[model samples]
Target: MAAGTPRVFISHLSGVAVFDPNGDQVGRVRDVVVMLRTGSRPPRVLGLVVEVVSRRRIFVPMTRVTSLESGQVITTGVVNLRRFEQRAAETLVLGELLDRRVRLIDIPGEEQGQAPGQGDGEEVTVLDVSMVQLPARRDWEIDKVFVRRGRQGRGGPLRRRGETLTVDWSAVMGFSVVEHEQGAESLLATFEQLRPADLANVLHHLSAKRRAEVAAALDDDRLADVLEELPEDDQVEIFGKLAEERAADVLEAMDPDDAADLLSELPESDKERLLALMQPHDAEPLRRLLSYEERTAGGLMTTDPIVLRPDATVADALARVRKEDLSPALAAQVYVCRPPEETPTGKYLGLVHFQRLLRDPPFTLVGSIVDTDLRPLPPDTPLPAVTSYLATYNMVAAPVVDESGALLGAVTVDDVLDHLLPDDWRESAHREPAQVPVPVPVPVPVPVRGEGANGH
Candidate 1:
């Protein structure tokens, strides 16, 4: 073990023969068990099992190793054959040694939300697996077959057992162990797997550019979910990287309230750009929501709700609901309102749960089916008070109305959570104060190295 010589582990010594100091061949070196010294412990080798007499087994202290050569090993002395006679069949077991070779896979450019199969339309490759062993954190079991020039070769393992190797598992395009000779470079080639929520958490930890790369790698639905979970600041930052049309598509896929909250944080110019790119129908609800104060009930409600005239048949209401693609938040309940009058004003009559509507006859008047005992909140009510009301009544959402009882919007449970606690609250709290630290003018030091014109 010279100071500059690289320390290496000898795996797969099965074909190497063993000899004693006298130059007589005793048997073969079946396996060499090395104890790994980790932390503050001194290094010690244990369980050195050797095959002898061509069919017998013997256990000897690693101190017996005289020298390891290219094709064989030399020992100080030979052991009694009878002592290993009973252990011949089990001498090759490397449970303690082999267990150290297990390694985890690491894939680059592939994040938690990206589809696992492909990356950016290109195939990914599974790189070499790393291995680690116990007690010796400094040493690794690297006896993997290294394929080079379309031929098989041997090399020391770079990773420890249970350690992960990031890889592109998309397709088996081609491979070369030389390509992964550098551990850091290899790890950088594979992507990491993470859940949607975890991905959002990671985005918050990354720079704006890195966040955008991850967002782009994800599918529309996954990116939308992550967008909903991200802080308003991060959402705006990441959204800036996407094309206006792509950004609008992601927003349209998001819950209207969540989309509104994100859009409200953008510059007015950027907001309008995104809105202009959105489908008119999808953009309409978000635009309307952006008009309201972020903390207000109207701002927190989804406008794409199911509404029916009190005089309309229950069947007709059901028909309208079935015909339209309503968001889950809006589809939870049906609001029964007065039929449109000449002035185009309608009154909020009552509410009907989707389940109840399905159980009643289609011809039944919506007013007859609407529960008169409606839990309604005024538009101007504070969000906290509205949350308390919902909890007290155990309601999924409460209808919001004007003084004249006109149906305005519905405040949902998700919106309530958003109103109560936004994602950036902590970051905002920990952020540096708005007032910049003023610079105190200091006396300037004159240069002494260079003298005046004559070089004095």
Candidate 2:
């Protein structure tokens, strides 16, 4: 190992594609794990949280990693597919360390070689960390930390105070590899930095009590986003922990389809109770969706989409698509109806593809060029039928209509794929321990439940 052998910053590692010996993409790197060393040794790289094709995260021991370069990580072919569980002693850099405000510890009257904050205890934010393969060491260890003072948020344009001050890992505090304890507020702050999907994955790996605590710590909107990405059982479990009103608010914040799916898993008593707590307008669509069998098109459709009336202009339609945060499949086209442009919209007339919108003048009516040729499916249409309808027309989404010809909702390809996957897909484990190369247990990181820094 050499100092110039190309060190990779931990911040740049997130979402980086990781490949196996055969060059097959396994998954993206979600987080890096390391163990704190005693004496003056730097923390050693232990493993990586790699999310695979099924969206299940697993641990890839550093011993199995061959190379980290060119924006991609290469593995030595030995992968332990067992879903990763954060050991008591392991510290997660990205998930727990990034964006933490810490006080730098320094010796008094040692200004010449003192750390930036000195003994004055100024707060600094850990932006990113660096890992290097030190000479004569088999493992890469945590080295220099990239940080900014007077700013405690995720990375943005590089900023500095008086001058860039380099601090060794020993200069910072709050990381304890012995009793990894964290205040509730510290964990909450760290959780806020993770993506919703990543947070959901992390919650899944946590103890039930820990999950409830973390869930309770999130705001409703954020909780709703994370809940949507979680499995039904986990969703229900977390919901059970929330107050009735809070749970309803979270449900209302969720996409109607996902909310309905979660509700459908609940008993009728619990379902009605929660529905009653939600706003009538928001609950109505979910009620209708729940009535449809889980395998039906109606059940898979999302209530929200870029909708337009026949009289609306292409510009109006385009503007709607632009303003709304819709998935690509849902935004591919705008549905044209008679009057109402909301869920359970007016009698379905047709749709305007994005290309057609671009071709027509902004003021041109969407109805004039609408593709009525694309027939909409009924609420009771089977999942197989919905799949065929989308495939036949090469459309990413298809409208679901009722007997009265009113647009109920629109089903996207993503929802359809969810149904097509094996029912136990979420429950399946993609990782299994390897017999030929067993991972030896080592010392763990005593973190403060998450990333946090305060000069000791």
Candidate 3:
């Protein structure tokens, strides 16, 4: 390690705020870019992949970084806005290396021989990497590895006997070599804190094969959440790879509207097969949704909106609104209905905005505070009308009812926007630039004053 250089664990830097030299917030760190070297040499740290406020990830070379302290990064303020694209030789530390199985050699200088203690040294799984900047240079390289000792089990490592330790980077092996069937347990652990949308973005940038591996590793609910945020093509591809029973379970875990949308993209035979695998009660709402036109309220609305009876108290409504899994739009208000709180609920009475609940006493009945004048949307309402209704009424979600006046679902603003945007909107929003500059191999030169990052 370089004298006076502070070693920082790569995992600790994930999602750390990046700022300009003048202290303006730039973005959050998404991943570290590193180039693996041949033989036993440590991989050189190339740059950071930062997701800015626009959600577009851009590359910021190590040279641009002025300080990494107090859990924040200070940069020289000259960041390129072009989207990041991975080079053939580069690897993402968080995406590719974490949780990977490797052997920790007993001797520091020995790179390839079996150790005198246990065969193949002691097997370990990588948990994180630590890097240090080279002395008098702007370059950085990984120097330490944090690893856990254990063979991987079906659920994960045998936690009771697993031991974790930090070792010199050169003491471990297998990072540079590609494993065709790498398990996603460790990688998923590194990303467990990410929101579904951010996790989906990370998955989007991985190789298709690795993406499938990660998707399969995620539990049903987590996979369902990520699938909803993923691009349609990616969604279809990953969903297609899961075993039929697991696929049906994941679909059932998803929001009814999202599950319906995914099913609509499949062949009739495949779609029906998965649907049949689901419980009859779970498949019923999806069947109803499929009967509606693609761009209509019935198709876009989620059947699981917060529904409450008129007799329910404001306290009851507030408790329902506090559910952690409810989206902001769906949690914005509570639909007041007669009997049967589930969708296809009896008589759509009215809605009580969350704001109204806040203003009333806990004992106040929702029936007394419900706003009936705003009117409910018919299931057949067109997409444009739904969008306009949300905007004009300043509503985050609007109730959708049938001719018989039963509440079927609620259309949230996000669902409306999803339909309004162009089919390729997601692709265009995060598209890579036409060209990318490949990093030069190590023995890196110090940056000259006023020199641009990655040669601009």
Candidate 3 structure lDDT: 0.83
The local distance difference test score of each candidate is: 0.55, 0.74, 0.83
How many steric overlaps are in each model, in order? 25, 8, 0
Q: Residue by residue across 1-456, what tens digits does model 2's lDDT show?
A: 234557777868877889876777878887898887785467888768877776666777765677888899887655655556677667788756665565566523444564554444555667777888766644678887665666422323333562335567766664552223222344455445677777777777665766776788788888898898777678889999899999999989998999999998888999999999999999998998888898998889998877887889988988877864567888899998887878788889988899889899999998899998888998889999998998888999999989999899999999998789876445442222222222323314323322221101
Instruction: Report how far residue 169 has shifted in candidate 2, in Å.
Output: 6.4
**Candidate 3 TM-score versus the reference:** 0.86
Which segments of candidate 2 are over 4 A away from where they belong? 3-13, 16-28, 36-43, 47-91, 95-135, 139-222, 427-456
The sequence of per-residue lDDT tens digits that candidate 1 reaches over residues 1-456 is 112223333443443667777777766654444333333232233434554443334554444455555666676553433322212112122322221121122224433454544323222222342222323232223322111121111232232333333332122222221121112221112223444554565355434544665577667777898887766777778888888778989988887877888888888998898899999978887877787776777777766567777788878777766754455556667888776521112888888887887888888887887887866777677778888888897777888877887777788887787667655553442231132211212212322311100001
**Deviation from native of the Cα of residue 220 in model 3, angstroms:** 2.4
TM-score of each predicted structure versus truth: 0.49, 0.68, 0.86
Question: Candidate 1: where are CA atoms >4 Å away?
Answer: 1-195, 205-208, 308-332, 338-347, 354-367, 402-406, 422-456
Deviation in angstroms for 402 in model 3? Answer: 1.5
lDDT of 3 at 68: 86
In terms of TM-score, which candidate is strongest?
Answer: 3
lDDT of 2 at 435: 28
Q: Model 3, which residues run further than 4 Å from truth?
A: 107-122, 151-160, 432-456
Task: Give the clashing residue pairs of candidate 3, or none.
Answer: none
Count steric clashes of candidate 2: 8
